[model samples]
Target: MRVAIVTVGDELLAGDTVNTNAAWLGERLTERGVGVERVVTLPDRVGDIARVVNEYRAEYDAVLVTGGLGPTHDDLTMDGVAAAFGREVVESEEALEWLAEAGGYTADDLAEGTADIPRGARMLKNPEGVAPGCVIGSVYVLPGVPAEMKAMFETVAEEFSGEVEHVASVVADEPESALIDRIDELRDRFDVTVGSYPGDSVRVKIQGGEAEAEAAAAWLRERVDLKETGE
Candidate 1:
């Protein structure tokens, strides 16, 4: 399954907040074998959010949106999603009940549009926070808080699946330049994606199907003096 991740926040665009949510979601989705095609960070504007979500939903199998989901005025993700589908924001009883059970929320808190969701959206229970997320069409909305996002993603992780990629890594004492030719050969010889990073040592990553990745790693090992293996 191919997916796009949309992280919304003005703070992110201004560099005030690091976009850890995008990176975290990317890793989680990759581990589940879902290919993340794009990660976009946008300002907390309903129109921009609606445009991107609408576009990505048509291109990708799913679009996961995080951030801009809260009780505050800047929280516009739900509204954007509703606009994307030409729907209205309505109070969700399921979300209200969940929020009530979660405790610490007064009637005033619930009445603050916290229970409002895009029409026709399926409420996603937030085990870690008061604000609930939802799924409208192929778009899965999530919270900006790292804890809440992680918890909510777990509830729907099973919905996404694709070819499970196997990864093998090896560290070569040689510089990346010295192994460039051999890496090229490995790629040509095996159906695996290879990446070489130059750090204290040249770290080579081989990713693909189990057999292909193993073969590519083994090929690299035979050509270079590997300082370390496995990742």
Candidate 2:
């Protein structure tokens, strides 16, 4: 399935922190055969988040939104997602229980800020931290903290399915310029795409395809490994 990612936070938009979550999640999704079609960054703006969430839902099969699920003021990811789906915020029982335990919110501590969520959203428990995320319509409001987001993601990964398997090999002491053209050509010949990664040692990543995986591997062995071209 095709998916889009929305990372919401002031830190990301202001460049105070690198948005490693997107790249990391994208790679994971790719490895599982899911296509990460789009990645978007937004400030803690409710209107902007709602707009993008609504727009992308029409284009992609799923949209995985991260950031802004904290109790602090700038945490507005849920609000935007809720708005995008035209829903009202309500206190979630599952969330309340999880929050009371996970978020340090007691019965009295379950105030307006900590226990509310969009109506009809399926609760995605946050065991790593407080601020439980929810899935409103097609938009999934996830945590901004990498650790929490990853934890929450692990709990719900099976729901988003499109499984991709990739195979790659390393070519020591080779230039990507020497391989790009051939790799692109191989992309056509093989059922999957070939990408040449540049570094002190080169890496070639071949996309997974049931029909062409073995053949593609054989071809790479011939051109890159067997002769040790050293180009």
Candidate 3:
């Protein structure tokens, strides 16, 4: 399955906060064998979130949106997501009960929009915070806070799964330029994707079906003096 990730925050654009949510989600999703097709960061603008969510939903199998899910004024992700599907944002009684029970705060004591969510969306419990995330259609809305997002994702992690590719990595003593021809030959001979990272030493990564990846790794090992193996 291919998924798109959308992160909403003005702080991210201003370099006040790092966009680690996207990277973490990408790694987790990739580990589950799901291909992350796109990672987009946007300001906490309803229009931009709506447009991107609308567009990505049609293009990808699923869209995972994070950030702008707090009770603050800049938290406009839900509004934009609601607009994407022509849905209304309404106060959810179930969510209110969750917030009250989990956070020990009554409805009156909470923020104005604490329990507001897109109508018809399934609320996702946030184990790490009071503001719950939700799922609308093919889009899974998640909190921006790294801790809350990671905890919430575990609740629905089983929903995303695909064919897992085998991965093998090796560190070679040769320079990157000197390995291009061999890398190309390996790709031509095996049904695997190869990546070469240049540093003090070249690190080559091979990914594909188990047999193909193993074969490709072995092929590379025979030609290049590998310093490290199996990453």
Candidate 4:
């Protein structure tokens, strides 16, 4: 499955909050065989969030949106999602019940719109926090809190499964410049995607389907003496 991740927070855009959620989601999705095509970080504005979510939903098989699902004023994710679908925001009884069980809130308090959700969206149970996630169409709304987002994602991870990827890597103590031709040759010869990282040693990572990845690795090994980094 192809997916896009939308991380919503002014703090993230301001560099106050590191965008670990995007990285984490990318890793988790890849491990599940889902390819993450894009990642977007936006301020907690209803229009911005809605526009991005709507755009990605049409472009990708699924869009995982994180952040802005709290009780605070800036938590506009839910509202943004509703606006994207042209749906009205209404107090969700399911979310209100969940919040009541989580404590610190009464049914009447939640009735005042603390547990608002987009009409016709399915509620995603949030075990770690009060704000429940909701899925409207292919867009999966999630809490911005790392712990909460992780938990909610795990609950529905099966839905995002896709073709399993095989990864192979070549590490060389030589500079990246030494392997440019060989890397280009590998790309021309195989269906793998090549990624290069330069540091004390240069690392070339190859990713593709199982047989293709193995063949690419073998080709690279035959052409160059790859360093045995054991990484």
Q: What TM-score goes with each of the models?
A: 0.93, 0.87, 0.96, 0.92
Ranking by lDDT: 3, 1, 4, 2
Provide the overall lDDT of each model, using Cα atoms, as 2-decimal numbers.
0.90, 0.80, 0.93, 0.88
Residue 31, candidate 1: C-alpha displacement in angstroms: 1.2
lDDT of 3 by residue, 1-231 (tens): 999999999999999999999999999999999999899899989999999999999999999999998689999999999999999899888898898888888989888888888999999999999888999999999999999999999999999999999999878999899898999899889999899999979889999999889888988999998776457
When 2 and 4 are scored with lDDT, the better candidate is 4
- List runs of model 2 lying over 4 Å from the truth: 101-104, 170-172, 225-231
Which candidate wins on lDDT? 3
Candidate with the larger lDDT of 2 and 3:
3
- TM-score, candidate 4, is 0.92
**For every candidate structure, what is the RMSD over all alpha carbons to the true structure, in angstroms?**
2.1, 3.0, 1.9, 2.0
Per-residue lDDT over 1-231 for candidate 2, one digit per residue giving the tens place of the 0 to 100 score: 999999988889888999999998897787677889899899999999999999999999899999988667888887888889888777788888877676667768644566668989999898787778888777777888899999898888887777666575546355777776667777778787666677666777666765576678667767763325557
Q: Please provide, for model 4 over 60-124, each residue's C-alpha lDDT reduced to its tens digit, 9 standing for 90 to 100.
A: 99999999996788889999999999999888888877777776678756535567789999998
Query: What is the per-residue lDDT of model 1 for residues 52-168, given as tens digits with 9 covering 90 to 100?
Result: 999999999999999988678999999999999999998888887777777767657664778789998999999988888999889999999889999999999999998879999
Clashing residue pairs for model 1? none
Worst 10 residues of 4 by lDDT: 104-113
lDDT of 4 at 110: 54
